[model samples]
Structures are given as structure tokens and as C-alpha cells.
Target chain A: DVKVTQSSRYLVKRTGEKVFLECVQDMDHENMFWYRQDPGLGLRLIYFSYDVKMKEKGDIPEGYSVSREKKERFSLILESASTNQTSMYLCASSLLDRSNQPQHFGDGTRLSIL
Target chain B: AQTVTQSQPEMSVQEAETVTLSCTYDTSESNYYLFWYKQPPSRQMILVIRQEAYKQQNATENRFSVNFQKAAKSFSLKISDSQLGDTAMYFCASEHTSGSRLTFGEGTQLTVNP
Candidate 1:
């Protein structure tokens, strides 16, 4: 089974603090994604990395950035945490294959910004 | 941009009954994939079922199945013999054939009563 491990299951940060959410997938998938799931808005993509050092901004990537220094690890960085940024963060990974493979997601990191 | 919508905000069904969750999407891209994802209270996103735009037959997985109407741009999920474990938030998502990003709907909360 594929396993996506999130560094933190629960996190609390101040408004101006810098936050980092880490994700590691054991499947060595080539594509990794960061998404923030909100109550009524659903899961909005923040950023995605198709390969090491290659990242693309998604619809809701305004206050977020991503890094993929290695194939197994992907990181989501909140430039400065804001109260509005408080939500459940999910990390997903899928193989960059021609076949339609499902993206496996981590348990999720519930971040609370005060 | 592709947008997904789940009209039903909440739905309930008896343990032995069946329930269906509706999903509609707007997209200009002809080649794409539609998916239903289940997010339980544990906050983990699990892929329920997926349907390819080109496939005429709907997809099914055990007790879970999809009613895909390509021309109507509608994809609904039906859970047969509903169980308490089926209680969760069901999200409809779409992904373009050329891209890996998934656009998700607001989600419909499902409850299976005994």
C-alpha cells in the first residue's frame, strides 16, 4: 500500500508566524500536490510539483509556496500564517504515468492560525 | 477553469437502503476524468470511484457505483446497502487529461442511519 506521511497532524500558529507543512510519500510518485480543504469552499489546490525543483501555482496559491528538493518529500510553506489560512491541509501524490492513477493523500494536517 | 458542484449539501439513508449523491461539472475540455472522493471524520481523502470521459460504461466498486452522464455533465455516486461506515463527506472532482490538478466540489455530507 502507498503511504503518504504528514509531518504534523495538528498545528497551531500565530498570525504572523511562518509555517511549514511537510509531506513524504513512500511510493516515489513523480507528482505531489498541496491542497487546503475549507468548510464550504472544498479542497483548493495551493501548489503542485511534477518533478524535483519544478513547481506550479494552482488556483489558490496566493499566500503559499512549495518546494520539492527530493523525489520523496514535498513541502508547503505559508509565507506568513493568517487567521484565514486556518484549515485542513492535505498532501497528495500520484505517478506521472499515462494511465489514470488516483492520487493518494495523507491523513491531513489541521492547522489553526490565531 | 473547470468547476465542480455538489447540489446536495446533506443526505441521509437507512443502513440497508441506498443513497445517491449528485455532482455536476462545467468544463470545456473534452478529455477529462471525473472522480468521487470520500473524506471521513478522520480527515483522510479516499478515492471512491472514477469515470473516464471517453468511457461509455459507468464505473463501479463493490457496493459503490457511479452514474455518469457525459452529455449532461453529471456524475452521481450510488452506495448500495448503505452502511454506517459510508457516513462521510463526498466530494466530486475533475481533472483534465493533460494536467494533474483536481478541482473539487463543496462536498455533500452523508449519514447512514440504523
Candidate 2:
């Protein structure tokens, strides 16, 4: 079974703070993704990395960035956390194959900004 | 880019009954994939089922199955003999065969009453 582990399950931060959310996958999948899930709006992609040191912006990438320094770890960074940035964040990984494998997701990190 | 839509925001069913969640997608690519993911109270994204555009047969797993209509770009999930454990927020998503990103629907919150 694949395991995607997020460093924190619940986190609280003050406004204007820098927040870091870490994710590690045991499957060594080539693609990693960061998404923010909000009520009614569902899950929206924030950023994704296809390979180490390569990142791409997703639909909702403002105020968020990502790093893939190693194949097994991906980190999501909020430059300046705001109250509106508080939401459930999910990390997922999948094999970068043409077969279109399903993504395996972590348990998710629910961040609260005060 | 692909777009997934789940019109029903919430649904309910009694235990041992059956329920179906609807999803529609719009994508220009002929080769694509569709998926149904369940996010339970635990906040873990679980892949319920997957369907490939080139396949004529709908995919099924245990009591979970998908009704896939390639021409209409519709993919719906049917849960038979639903149990209390089936209660969750179900999301429908789509991705191109060659692409790395997934477009997800707003999600349908399904509640199963005992």
C-alpha cells in the first residue's frame, strides 16, 4: 500500500505568518500535488511537482508555493498566511505514467489562521 | 483543461439501500480517465473506482461500481447495499491520459442512516 504522510494534521497560525506544510510519500511517485479543500468549493489544486526541483502552478496558486527538494518529500509554503488561507490541505502522489494512475492522498492537514 | 461537475451537493440513504452520485465532465482530449474519490470524516481521500475512456466496460469493485458514458462524458458511482461506513464526501475527477493534473468536482456529501 502507498503511504502519503503529512507532517501536521491540525495547525494554527496567526495572520501574516509563514506556514509550512510537509508531505512525504513512501511510494516514490514522480508527481506530487498540493490542494486546498474548502466547503462547497471542493478541492482546488494549488501547486504540483512532476519531478524534483520542477514545480507548476495549478488553478489556485496565489499566496502559495511548493518545493520538491527530494523525490519522496514535497512541501507547501504560504508566504504570508491570511485568515482566508485557512482550509484543509491535501497532498497526493501518483506515478508519472501514461496509464493515468489514480493519485494516493494523505490524511490532510486542516490549517486555521487567526 | 478538463472540468468536472457534480450537481448534487448532499444526499442521504438508509443503510442496506442503494444510492448513486452523478458526475459530468468536459474535456477536449479523447483519451482521458475518470475517478470517484471518497473523503470520509477522517479526511482521507480514498479512490473508490476508476474508469478509462477507451474501455467500454464500466469499472466495478466489490459493491462500488461506475456508470461510464463515454460519448456524453458522464461518470456516476453507484453504491449498493450502502452501509454506515459509506457515509462520506464523494468527489468526481477527470484527467487526461498524458496529463498529470486532475480536475475535481465540488463533491457530494452522502450520509447513510442506520
Regions more than 4 Å wrong, model 2: A98-100
lDDT of each: 0.94, 0.94
lDDT of 2 by residue, B55-79 (tens): 9999999999999998888999999
Report clash pairs, candidate 2.
Answer: none
lDDT of 2 by residue, A26-76 (tens): 997999999999988889999999999999999999999889999999999
Q: For residues A81-113, what per-residue lDDT tens digits would candidate 1 score against the true structure?
A: 899999999999999983769999999999999
Candidate 2 docking classification: high
How many clashes show up in model 2?
A: 0
